[model samples]
Target: MEILQVIILGLCLGFVYALMVSGLTLIFGVMRIVNLAHPILIISGAFVSYWLFILFGLDPILSVPAAALTVALLGVLLYKLIFEKNAAQQTYSEMTVLLTFGTAMVIDGLLAFLFHNTQRTASPAYATDAIFIGDIFIPLAQLYSGMVSLGIIVVLALFLKYSEFGIAIRATSQNRTSAELVGVNVKFVCLISFAIGCALAGSAGSLVSFVFSFFPSRHWEWIAILMSLVVLGGMGSLTGAVIGALVLSVVSSLVGAFYSPAWSTMVFFLALFLILIIRPRGLFGIRTD
Candidate 1:
């Protein structure tokens, strides 16, 4: 029963991680530039939620959309001021990597200055609530986060399949030049993709805050883990991100349960190294033009 509970808990956390990775994968798919600031954006979202909870007394779940909107706007501004102009240059990807990394450092510095290095966590009344099912206990916060993550995944999949902008985004990602030739606004698509990607990351951060402790500098750790997940999952595959998250989370949880918590992180990185060795392009590599 205890083992079963751990698996369930791990899967719940995995879903949230998958949601965050999906956003990173989406941006990579369309832009071919990994937003190194993704985790810092998440940290910003966490602060947003924290402020909302403290000021307005709103639930973290309810504050998610607000965080998402704020991050989305920031993403658009970033694209226009930085990424869009750089995209026209020959070294767009390399430039973006350095630019986003710099942006992350700036954010980290700002957060540290404002919030200090102390650990903080968002806790609503239901944070510690749990449900029991046949001797297995499921945390309410994790379950809620999982459901929201799954819903976001489903909505994203359907939107890509059905929405007009979604189709345009896909077309642009598949071939930017061809898409532009066919009258698709490639620039607009990239802007929207970046916004949506950051928004997803924001939402995931807000949701997970209910169950996780965070510090101003913790974004660095998360960025490393997320980068590993994104690469091992396949740089631009949403489903691959989900699979990678599940694999990593389950392994980590099991290791932590049987061994030490420190060993769990080691296990995750070891798995990532092994996966990359076996599949150079990741588990679900998509050929981009």
Candidate 2:
């Protein structure tokens, strides 16, 4: 029963983690450049929910869209002002790494200045509510957040399958030059992809606020965990991200339950190492040969 509870909890948390990395994976797939500032945007989302909850009494769940929108606008501004300028540079790939790293530093400092690094969690009234089923326990917050994450992933998948913009984004991701030759606005696709990624980050942040305590600098830890998941799942594969999140989250949860929460964090690195050793392309990574 205890093992069952742990697995269930792990699965729920895995869903949230999957949603967390969706944007990161999307941006990588489309732009072929990692946005190191991605985690900071996620933290910004948590802060957005935190502020809304404190000032307007809005629930964290209700604040998800607002958080997503705010960060998405920020994402657009970032792409237009910073990334777009370097989009055509021959060194764009390497440049983006430095650029995003610098951007992340700036955002981290700004958050610290505005929020003062205080540890906080957005706790709605239902935060403490739970469901019990024959000795199994499930927290309402985790259950709802997980359900919401899964639903959003499904919607995103469908949008990519059927929507015009989604088709364009997919085309650009597959082959930028070919997409442009076929009349796809590659630049716009990049911008939209970045925005979508940031929006997902914000949405994940709102969920994170309820599931865990967070602070301005907490993004450092999250970034490490998520990057590992991204790499483990395959650098640019959304399906891989979800699978990696589930695998690692369950491993971490089981370790925490049987061993120590302290060791659970190490599971990410261990799994990453093993996966790299066995499948360098990741579980779902495309073969390059």
Candidate 3:
């Protein structure tokens, strides 16, 4: 029963984890540039939700779209100011990494200056509330967040598969030069894709507004684990990211249940190492040239 409970909780949490990393994955998939600022964008979303609830008495669910769109707008500005200069560049190896990392630090520093590195949590009464069936229990906040995560993933999948704009995005992701040759506006695609990616990070943060305690610098704590999920899943692969997140989340949960909680943090690193050793491309990752 305890193990079953652990698995259930792990799955729920995994959705949120997957959601957290999905934006980063999508950005990488489309641009091949690792956005180090992705974590800070998530932190910004959390802060937005926090303030919305604290100052305006809005619900976190309502804050989702608000925060998402706000960050998406910010993402556009970022693309214009920072990524645009290098837009025509084929590879984003050293300079892009440095730029994004620097951007992350600047965002973090600004937040720290304002929020003072203090842990701020959005308190909605239902955050602690739970649903139970027989002997099983589920936290309402996490469950709602998980549902939102899954819903977003479904919507994104549909968009990519059906929408004309999404088709263009997909074509660009597959081959930017080919997409441009076919009359697709690659620049527009890149901008929209970046916004969508940032918006995803925002919505994911809003979902967890009440579930996690966060400080401005918390992005530092999250980025490593999130990156592990990306690497373990095979960078830029949505399915891979989700599967990898589920596997790592489950492993971490089980480790905490069966072993010392201290060892739970090692689960991700261990899982990544094992997966990399076994299949260098990850569970479902396929690199395209």
Best by lDDT: 2
- Which prediction has more favorable lDDT, 2 or 3? 2
Residue 233 CA displacement from its true place in model 3, Å: 1.4
Report the poorest 10 consecutive residues by lDDT, candidate 2: 280-289
Tens-digit lDDT track of model 1 for 35-67: 889998888888889788878888989998998
What pairs collide in candidate 3?
none
TM-score of 3: 0.97
Model 1, residue 221: displacement in angstroms? Answer: 0.6
Report RMSD (Å) for each prediction in the order shown: 1.3, 1.2, 1.2
Comparing 1 with 2 on lDDT, the higher-scoring candidate is 2
Q: What is the lDDT of residue 30 in candidate 2?
A: 90
Give TM per candidate: 0.96, 0.97, 0.97
lDDT tens digits, residue span 14-48, model 2: 99999999999999889877888888999999999
Q: Rate residue 33 of model 1 by lDDT.
A: 81
- Residue runs of model 3 more than 4 Å from their true location after superposition: none
